[model samples]
Target: MSFLELKNIHKSYHLGSQTFPVLKGINLAFDLGDFVSILGESGGGKSTLMNIIGGLDRNFDGSVTIKGKALNHKNEKALDTYRRETIGYIYQSYNLISHLTVLDNVLVSLDMTTLSKKARVLRAKELLARVGLAGQIKKYPNQLSGGQKQRVAIARALASDPKVIIADEPTGALDSENTKEVLRLLNEIASEGRLVITVTHSEAVANAGTRIVRLADGKIESDKRIRQAYDRQDKEHLSSRPLRRLASIKTAFKHFRHNLGTNSLIIFGTAIGLFSVILFSGLGNGVSHYISSQITKVANPQVMSVSRYVKDSDDDNALSMSTDDTPALSTNQLDQLKKQKHVAKVEPTYSIPSATVSYQNQTVKMRYASNWTAASTADAIKIGHAPKKAGEVVIDQDAIAKKLDKEHYQDLIGKQIQLAYQTNKPSGETVTVSLTATISGIGHSDSKGAQVNAVNTETLQKAMQQAGLSTDPTEASVKVDTLDHVEEVASSIDKVKDGHNRLYKTSTIQSLIKQLQTYVNIATFVLSMVAAISLIVSALMIIVTMFMSVSKRTKEIGILRALGESKRDIRWLFIAESLITGVLSATVATVIAYLAQRGINGVLRNLADYTFVQITFRNVITAFFLAIMISLLAALLPARRAAKLNPIDALSAE
Candidate 1:
């Protein structure tokens, strides 16, 4: 039996219900070490016949038997295996991957074999040396002359040690000197116990083969033996050579590196989106921390603030009424709060949002003031003493300096100041009260305002009653027995119900911190969402870039498939390229966010007590993962399109 046989092959092309027969009942046979050339005119079906024999075109009616077994054309994997292990095609155009070096082009074929990476490189170099291009192995195809490129193509064909070498006009584009050299190489290949088949229209090329076959109108017109075929005493069995997945990644990275300019822009665009998300999250955390710290300074953890929250009753329109008409915490409510678990003391206090104090014609507008108790006053006094008796008051030193001269401010510590504020009478009447009090001490100022003032609660209550104004406390300050029970006592106070089922709204240092944190989280989420919109643009950019890459690398895709890579391998190549871009972008974004955090903190160091932006590992990692996932999803369509391209069509692409 012949080593390779094509028995009665018939083929046709269909164009919209029109059948054009190309091959008409052709029979051919070849043994190992046979150098056969098929000569034909331009439209004599010679190319189609070569395609069928090389396992590239399967749409034919034929029995292709190799070693006495018929080829299963319907099995895709079987066809790929046959092409990989048994056939090496040398195209006339020398279709080499433009980005790969000459040696790398040869290794593309060997990547499918079981040879180790070092062994493959060694073999590729040897093949290049054999083709007289050893010194030019690192050069790209475009850097080589036509003759040299053809030599490189021949080296690539021989790299896999294929059983059959198919040269489709291998020297058609070469001059006389190069043509002679290429023909000698083909003959040498035939002498190496391999079947060499060359298809050409030149009669001189056909005469160089050991056997000559002529075709006319898709039919074999003549067959002549010019010389004896090499004898095959020992038969070699072909082994399976599957494509290596990592080889595609290496190839993809090579292509990406080759076009770094465009890919860099893509990576930068993606990094911007990731940087925004990471930086904003860190900023929110820092802002929340700053707010919580400020709150801690204002409210002691062992102290809880309780206020009456009047629910709408059916008997009254309380929502439409003024603050004076709204209910304040009555005496019974304060007594009840003081009786709760872990309650050490409850101080009924009256708060006024706007107040005025005057010392001898010098006046200052106080933004906040509240009737004070001994427990509240003891923590804030910086000089002199707190309000221990009926007519004493403590004021902020910063507020006093802003109003009076510095010399006068020091001498006014024992001087009397007139305090005035609006109040509500029991008969639903409004009145203004002006009371005189001695300045007993000074307190620290805050960011909100410098007007921190406190007067004795009992003295203020008596002054309100004498002025015919209701003196019921608007808010009560509950002092917990211990700092550990502050949260528990606050919760209990919040849940305390009256006969009308109304509970007091409670605020503690811990609760205030939580509320501020919640606000910060909401702001962060909103900012992150706004930043994430850029990722859509980034994803679109990735899609466009990947599609452009696929378009530009069409021929490369064809070369890989021709070298035994499956469609899945081609798809993975593009996906790997996209992932590489994503990871690089993520790294850049993380670095930028970290630097921004440091810069922001440095700029705000003197203004605030703590850092303003904190970039955590979680934010960095999340940003990176999101970037990669978006890029991978964006690349799916381009990858599938590349994988589905026909190798023959791709090879013919301009």
Candidate 2:
């Protein structure tokens, strides 16, 4: 059976305004080790027939059988596999990948192979040696002669060890001497037991083949067998060029250089986007960390102990402390708490109605309930020191500046202010208990979720008892550093109070910290998502740039596509271009994001003592993934369009 057989091939194209038919009905057969040359006019379908045979174009109605297996029209995978594994091609324009080194160009087809990089290099070298280009393996396509480049193209074709080799106008671009040199190489390749098919106008190329096939108007006109002269080396000028290597990374790098400008711009755009997200994410992390540190700094631990209750024992009390009729503690009872086994410090607190200020015959109505906290912990003071005595008031800056007198914001500090304290007893008793004090110092405004109006705990308890409020040791309040010693502390207080004294270990600062953390997380996430849009734009920008590039490079891609590369390989080249751009952009974006976040953090530190964390490794990795996806997505359409181009029309395009 023949190695390749074409049975009644027919192909046409829609030219917008008209239909152009190239191949009428073509029938041909060629045996293994045969070399056939096709001569055709410029308007003829020589390149079109080549495209069909090479599987780049399947729109034609025909059967191209290789090794008795007919090419499938419906299954794209089958066609791809057939093209990948079966065909070897060299084109008239040399079609040497311009960006690849001579050696690397030979190994491009073996990317997915299990053969080690070194093995692939070795094989590529052997093929280049066969084509007499062994020394120029590291040289780029432009650096080689026309004849030498064609030889490299041939070497690339044979690298996969295919049974059929097709050469379309292999000598078309060469001078007479180089043309003769390339034709002789073809004769040698065919003699080595592989089918050689050539399409060209050169009679010499047609004569050199062992079997010649001529085409006119896309139909086979003649098929003839010819003799090859003995002592082929006499006509073959041999060069001892060492084998070339398939430098995959190096090849990619060259294309990267060739298309650097367009890619860099797209990458820059994407990087800007990632920068916004990374900075915001970092901001969130840093803010939460700082807030948590602050919370722990001020928190005193709570003491926990079980309570035993009587039936409705003290239910009649108004400022009620009794739950299930529990009685309250006396001053002596509260003082006895210090003697408990594991007791540390205990303080009692009572509530009062909102104080009404009377100054200069004017009465200001106060609304929100007034409360206080233990002033022992220094971290609780955001302004001047805690109240030195009961008559001294520590006013927060927020209250003095905004709530009091905005015109004389700072004047209120250190001034005497009268407080009319109204007390409510647990026994449903109400009394007008008031005090006069001076604003000793101004404190900073406390954030939300903080316990406001903190004062000295000891003074607070005395005032509560005077107002007939509960100071029960059984329900006493105490603060410790941690929850670890709650049981020990609770056991000691159990003796003084009627019921177990419950140490309420609530962290006001901690609540604020959680709020800060939530704000940061949301801010960072939102910013990051918004930044992702820029990356997407950058990706699509690559597609647009590539499409424009394809428009500019249509002929170049057409030349490569006609060289028997599968549509995937063609598309991959375009994708490869975008992929390089994406990676580069990621690297740039990460650097920019780091610098940007750091700069913003520096500004914030100036406002107060603040430390902001920089963008994480996680953020950088995310940017990388996004860049790749964007670049690939951008390349998809242009690559597909390039792959689907008809070689004949492409070649015929001016």
Candidate 3:
């Protein structure tokens, strides 16, 4: 058998639902050290034949046997190996990765090899020098002349020391001078006992080859001998490592290095969207976590709370009742409410909302006025014991807005503070008073009064009188005899008219969480949506980048097809590039967001006086998922467009 052989081969393509046969029963054979030239006109399928031979396109019919192994319908993986290990390709356009230096470009395909880094570098330099690029190894593709770039391509083809070098008009893009210089490199590669199969339209280059093969309508019509044959090595000297399958992550990185200026600008452009999405989501999460924690710390979950809604709240014109105009329940209404089915023990409480606290004449208006419940409710306080009598008041941790020299977060607990108050007379006259009360307790509110404490009589009376005009009022929680009956008692409390304003302990706390959640949820929605816009922008950025790559590498994509890189591979290449860009962009975005989130947390933490919730590592992981999903999704459409490109036109485009 000849060193390389092809039995009758056939190929066809589909256009708009119709099948057209292109390559009809063509046969050919060749051997090592043969500089074989094939001359053909445009549209004659010379490149297609070269692509099939190089195993880039594996859809052809019939046998193409090399060294007794048939290359028939092998899977893409196997063909990929065949192309990487057995065939080296040179194209009309050099197709050097634009961002990589000549030497580094030569090292890309060998990424998965076990060769030492130094050895790899040395090998690349040696090959580049052999191709007359010794001094140009560090120069980027654009920095070199057209001939220099083609020489680098030739050196790259030889770097892995493949058994066959397939050149499809390698000299086509060059002027006559550069074309001759590149041809001289091909002649040298062939002279070194390597098989050089070149498809060209140049008659001069064809004359220098040892044999010439002519094609008409895709079949070899003539085989002409021009030189004596010489023996050559058929076994590859390099590893059969696959380009993208094996750990070519390094290759992708190297490719990135070559394209840094272009890709960096692209990635930077995409980051705004990504950063926004993460930040909003993260901030929302932080707020949610904070509120949830605050609620849990302040209440018991198994206990249910009952609240009364304004019956016609949905009516936009519902009458607005003034806080003071809403008449307090009468003693008879209170009695009727107490007699309800689940009637539990109840307390009568009084609140003077306009009350202010005074410390040596300085006062801060209380957001929450004096709140009194049945002594039972006092047990819910976090710091002190339950209170039994009037004048002794339990304070909220932040009730005092005044700057105090206190130490702990809840330091106002045992400190002495006074309640100053005023009352509006029925005749529309306002009266203010100087009644003083000591802090008898400090606590959080919850049902059951678990944390509640008793207030001493002295403080209780002071609060009642200091608020300008409160006759002694009693406040209580209905301690229902049974757990299930508690809800009934809570509901009944809502129907009561107590001659004085009264609020059920359970309803107030529930309303607090609901109100707080509403406000927080709005923030979460706004901030997260703001962040999502960034991710959307990032996706668009990725698409733009992939589109640019497809545009710039049109010639390379065509050459890849000619060298047996399938339409699939061409598409995959674009996808791979997008994924790479995504991964890189994600990494960058992650770093930025991570630092930003932490910085926010750091500032907030120091403002611990202002911050209630603590942000943790969970934020990082949340942001990571956002980035990866956006990245992969962005590449899908661009990859499809790349796959649909016609190789003939892509290659022919300048």
Candidate 4:
């Protein structure tokens, strides 16, 4: 039995219903240690026969039997395994992948095996050294001469330790000296007990082999043996070297580094996209914080203003000032509010309708006056102090400035002030009273609206009772334990159902804070979407770039296919390149965004009193992931194209 057999091989090409037969019923037998050359003229089907024997062309009608197993043309995996384990190819073009060094070109084959990284490198280096390319291993294919490139191709073929070495016009492009050198290497390879097959048109090249077969008009005309095939001695067992596998990461990195100028532009373009998203998001957060701080600065976050019910119309001053209709809060309601989560203290409040005040012959018709025990906790006071005794009062500086015909109303503090107001009792009777008290403090002018003097609730209530007015507090101020829980507590209070329609109306600076934040978020999302369009454009750029790369590396893809790489490997190689670019772009954008945030915040700090840009780590991670996903999706079409290319046609591509 022969080591390899081809039975009834037939191949042809078709052009618009015209049949052009290339090979006709060709049969051949091959054995280990045979250095056989197939010699023929142009169009004599020597190349077609070589392609069939090397497993590159499966369209032929034939049964290729190796070691008693026939090849299955339908099973791609089986064909790939056969090529990887049993056959090696040396192209006439010396198809060394241009991006790889001589050593890396050999290592490309070794990467398919299960050998360790160290073992693979050692074996690749050994193969290069054996081919007399030891010192030239670091050089690229373009840097080497024709002879040296051919030597590198030989070393790559030997790296996989295949039993069959197929050379298609291996010496076709070399000088006489280099051709002799390659021919001698082929004979040495055959002498190591492996089959060496070559296709050539030169009779002298065919004569160098142990056997010669001549093809004419698509059929073998003669087959003759010049001598017995060289047999290896016991001490010369070079074909038994173990196969070692290498990673493709190094290949991807090499490609990236080789085109740094182009790739750097891509990275920068992608980084700009990512930077915009981060910058806008950070700016939104900063603006939201600044607004929140400003709003809460005048009021207290932990202090919630509780009213019987909010007046639906700001013009309904009568409803607002009518204390008779004021809904009395029940003891049960106060207890419930105190028991609520995070509620620390609840203070009762009293109001007197239609109050009039006089100080030093300047009388003013004041709005409804209220006394909240928790008023001292608010930062609304601008001068003096909050009322601490029954007879002490805090006046609004703005209202006093108007009545006094002067600014700087702080002089009114520590002076006695007269107040008169009418209040309706539970008996439906109107009561009028007048009292005098010393002004204690002046509240800030920016306290939302025209404010009345604020006093202790107990002090005001006691005086009202003496005047025959109802003292059952009209409103209450609920103090939460922490500012963070103020909104939550307010929500729970609003949810408390009661028979009265005016159960509780909650208001705090938090409502304004949330409204501002909502606007910021909407603006940020819209801006980010606009920025993401640039990323989409960048993705399109990546697609175009990857397609261009695939076009340029078609021959390299063929070389890889010949080296036993699966289609999936080719796809992943391109995908990995995009992934690397994504990560690099993301890293650069994050750094730039962080620095931009610092610069903007620094400028804002000088202009205002707050930072205007704040970037979080979450933004960084999101930007990175978005960039990578976009890049990967963009490369899919190009990667698939590279993977599906025909190996034979790719090798023949210029």
Task: Indicate which candidate wins on TM-score.
Answer: 1
| Cα shift from native, residue 359, model 2 (Å) | 25
lDDT of 1 at 188: 92
Candidate number that wins on lDDT, 2 or 4: 4
lDDT of 1 by residue, 54-127 (tens): 88776899789999999998887888888889889898999988889999999889888888989899999999
* Residue-wise C-alpha lDDT for candidate 2, range 353-453, written one tens digit per residue: 35665444544444322223441345655545656666566555554334667676566655665556665456667766555556655555233434334
Q: What are the runs in model 1 whose C-alpha is more than 4 Å off? A: 231-241, 300-304, 313-323, 330-332, 338-347, 352-363, 371-397, 401-472, 478-495, 507-533, 604-610
The most accurate candidate by lDDT is: 1
Every model's Cα RMSD, please? 4.6, 9.3, 8.1, 5.7
Candidate 3's C-alpha lDDT? 0.64
Candidate 2 global CA lDDT score:
0.64
Evaluate all candidate structures by whole-model CA lDDT and list the values in order. Answer: 0.83, 0.64, 0.64, 0.81
lDDT of 3 by residue, 1-654 (tens): 776787888888899999887888888888888899988888777887887788766677888888888875467656666776778888777777775678877876554345767888889998887877899877889899888888888887887777789998898888888877887788777877788999988788898788998888877889999888656744437674434433334444565666789889767655655665566666666666565455545433223332223343343122122245434434554465467675554444444555576665566666444345432343346665544444456655444522332355355554566665666755777877554445655665432222322334445555446545544343333345665665455555555543554432234334455566677768867876776766676677777877776787777665554334445555556666666776677667667776787778778775442333333366545555665666667767776777666555676778
